[model samples]
Target: MLVLGIVLFALGLMFSIAWHELGHFLAARRFGVRVPEFMVGFGPTIFSRQRGETSFGIKAVPLGGYIRMIGMIPPAPGQRIGRSRRSGPFQGLIDDVRADSVKDFRPGDEDRQFWTRKPWQRIVVMFAGPFMNLILAAVLFLIVLVGFGIPTAQPVVQSVSKCVVPASQATTTTDCPPGAPPTPAAQAGFQAGDRIVSFDGRSYDSWEDMQLAIRASSGTVPVVVERPEPNGAARTLTLYPQLIETQLLDLDAARTSGEPRYVSGSFLGLSPIQPVTRQTPEQVAGYVGEMAQRAVTSILALPSKVPALFGAVFLGEQRDVNGPVSVVGVSVLGGEVLASNNAVASEIATMLQLLAAVNVSLFLLNLLPILPLDGGHILPALWEGAKKRIARLRGRPDPGPVDMAKLMPIAYGFAIVIMLYGGLVILADIVNPIKLNL
Candidate 1:
């Protein structure tokens, strides 16, 4: 099962990379830019085929993919292709990049180059890749939320505690201790599988609202519950149980920090049953929004996590559960999920969610305004557009396309850093991988 899960995830990753490149290919073609190659993965070609003007192929490595568009870096202003008069330490690098950008140039293809397209068209071509990832993530999220459903706490009681255990004394055991007072739910004859109907004369639909009402009640309240009979019918029961204030953990504080903060509140001993509940489209949208926010936060915090990743890789340190993960790590997690003893539906849902998260991460990470990234291309296109607009407004000649060759040095440096970070993450993933609780 583990091997199967890993294979499945790897295949999904390849498909995702292909889909992303397809976005760029389609958009580039839409704007009449010449795309010579549409390939998934990096390294030497494993399989390739020429289709019309494009050569489609798979590569040796399955980590990333790309589409080669003509004139990605425009020639120097008023200069011939592959010619540079500038002399500097980075000049050779810039010239090499410029030379490669048009190495496959053919006759009468000047207008078909990517740099010849309007700024908005270039932006569309660049942004289309990441946009495909966003679309795939949303679709996956919808399938998981609407088809399989999400685990939600229902209003039905799963268990009823015999005694009221204060937050301070509640460490592990939930069994009744000596001299502990009986809980309000126990006194009111609450049982497992009973569905809460109303609390204090007001009807309740969700467990959360009923919990808030239970916490706010001061005196004896009319608690109504529908308990199932042995004959398969449910009978309504109303019982008046005096509410007592007790020490309880402050939920907000506990959620913010993994520390217990106790406060006096009305105590109820019922534990709600968790069941899979299908979500509406609005709820799914909200869930996806929250996930996207977390992905952004994770991307922003990547720098701070490098030290921990380094330690985990070289110093034999324990891996942080919430730390960064590489492709290897994600695959291992998928394996673990499948190998677990969870229900089949649960395992499938978890796998879908994991893939969805991967897509979301890809969508956001590629949008960073750094060279070689989709956003890097997008930023230059936007600047070129702005420059053209300003030149027109000032009655001056067009400033022309942004000099992408000059930015190659910075892009090279960023690429090196990315390689190092990716290497560290991959090493850590192999050595000290995060494991699922299941």
Candidate 2:
């Protein structure tokens, strides 16, 4: 099952890559840009077949993919066909870049070249790929949040803690020390499966409301719960649960840390039941919006996590679960999700969430305004548009397209850095993979 899940995930990734490239391919064709090839993955071609003006194929490496559009970069001014000259050290590299940019030149393709299109059209062609990823992410998020339902914290108790541990020494293990005090929940005879109905004469439907009430209480509070009897009758139980000052899990700061930060709060040792509940369309949209914000924030914080990533790999420190991951790591997680003892529904929901996350990452990663990315290409188009507008305003001749070949050095450097980062992440993933407790 795990192997099957990994294979399925790999296939999904391939589909995503192909879908992204297809967006660019279609948009380029729409804008009259001649596309020579539409390939998924990179490196040496595994198999290829020419259809019409385009060659379609997969490649040896599945790291990334692209569609080869004719004349992505504009030629140097005063440059002619079949001309080859190297001015200086870096000039040869620039010349090679500009030359290869138009190597697919056909007789009639001169006018259909990408650089010949309007700035808006070029922008649309470059933006289409990332837009496809965003669309996929939104669709998947809706499926998981509305169709399968989202896992929600309910006012039902799943378990009661056995003892109260000091905030400074708190751990996940429930093994109590000798002579440790009993938790308020245990002392009040709070058992598993009890549904919290009210606290301090206040009725609450959600666990969050009940939790706040507990945290704000400084003394014993009137607690009303609906407990199910073995005979199937529901009986009301009222116990003054003396709220104790103990360590509470800081939910906001606990995401990236292995050990949750403990803060003093009125502790009720009952764990809320996480029930899968469907959300409305508006609710799902809000959820996706929040996720998109978080995704953007994570991408921005990625560079800062490099040191931690290295420390975790070389210094034997625990790796943060929210740290960067390569495709290998994601595939391993998919396998782990399938191999877990969770129900089929739970597993499917988890995998769907994972896929949505992958799509979101894809969208954000490609949107980085650096060379070789979709956003990178969009930048030049925008600049050209601005330049043309300014030219018209000054009543001068319109300038040609931005010479993207000039940015090749920086693009090459950025590409190398990205490759190195990916290599490090892949190595870290293999050495210290995140173990998810389902």
Candidate 3:
């Protein structure tokens, strides 16, 4: 069942990627840019259909898509060296020639050239794919919030959760139910009914925030909180977060339809200070945005020496880095979260929410300044524009287009790194996949 869901969810995510690619495809077509092929997935084609000028196809591997824009980069491998041949045993003798052909070529017609377009136009065309993902995220969030209402459980004190206690009070306490509280987590002092408001500085909304902060802490954390007294008074507090073990529950299914079990974890044993419900679109967005911003700001503050974060790692001390995720990861997350304790309806909503989050993460990561990424390309374009402006001021000719010879090496190197990282992550995920216990 888990594998099935992953497969189906992956297909959905692929279509989402297809939608993103479609955004660029349609825009390019509209702008009269020649699009030779629009493919879903990479490697080899398994299915294809030609529509007007574009050949839309699905490759056997469900990875990512590519737009074969004329003159988008350089020429075909055979064309680069001016060789005329397709792959075959007979062509094996000319493998070197074919390889060099990728470098050759008659600089084709300018009409279909991507570089020929205005910078803004080119920027829009390039950004369209990621833009689609962002839009999809926003729309998904809006739908989840407006149509189904956000699935937020109250932070009310519950007997099932780990104990929440203030650091100062624990010294005088005599309760030792279950095994002694995790010292690391207890020393920092997290108590039930204390009301967790923020994580490492991010507003705490759902368990995701708490778990991320805890794991990021490498088992220790600096916590900020508001304690609501039974007498209607609120006192702000702080604590040292301790390392705690966690057992994840399948969140999606637990939303309702499946048996709900608790996932154990390192906890300050705290709940929201204030018990409030946000069921409206505006309320959900405003609150989720604020919480997400807090997480983002905390990450931004890493260099500023604020409470730093170090999440758990599977192997050694090193953290994992990889090329951007393909759809496979999202499905796995969706499946794992399904193990959570929740009603059926809530489970569905959580699944959607998780998917939105994955989309947002993917959307944002692509914007990092690296070659083959839109932002990376835009960086140089912006620099060239500045240079051109400066040259015009000095009454000199515009600086020539950037030297591809230099850029290609760096870009290809980065691409290789991405490929390698992606392979490793896939391998790690397979060996010890991230799983939740519901």
The models' CA-based lDDT, in order, is 0.86, 0.82, 0.57
Write the number of the candidate with greater TM-score, choosing between 1 and 2.
2
Can you write out model 3's per-residue Cα lDDT over 306-398, one digit (the tens) per residue? 111122124432222211233565578676655556566666776777667656655665666778676676666567667878999999986
Scored by TM-score, the top model is 2
TM-score list, all predictions: 0.83, 0.89, 0.63
TM-score of 1: 0.83
lDDT of 1 at 342: 96
Q: Which ranges of candidate 1 are over 4 A from the true structure?
A: 160-190, 198-204, 208-226, 229-271
lDDT of 2 by residue, 339-399 (tens): 8898888888888788888888898899888988898999889999999999999999989
* lDDT value, candidate 1, whole model: 0.86
Q: On TM-score, who's better, 1 or 3?
A: 1
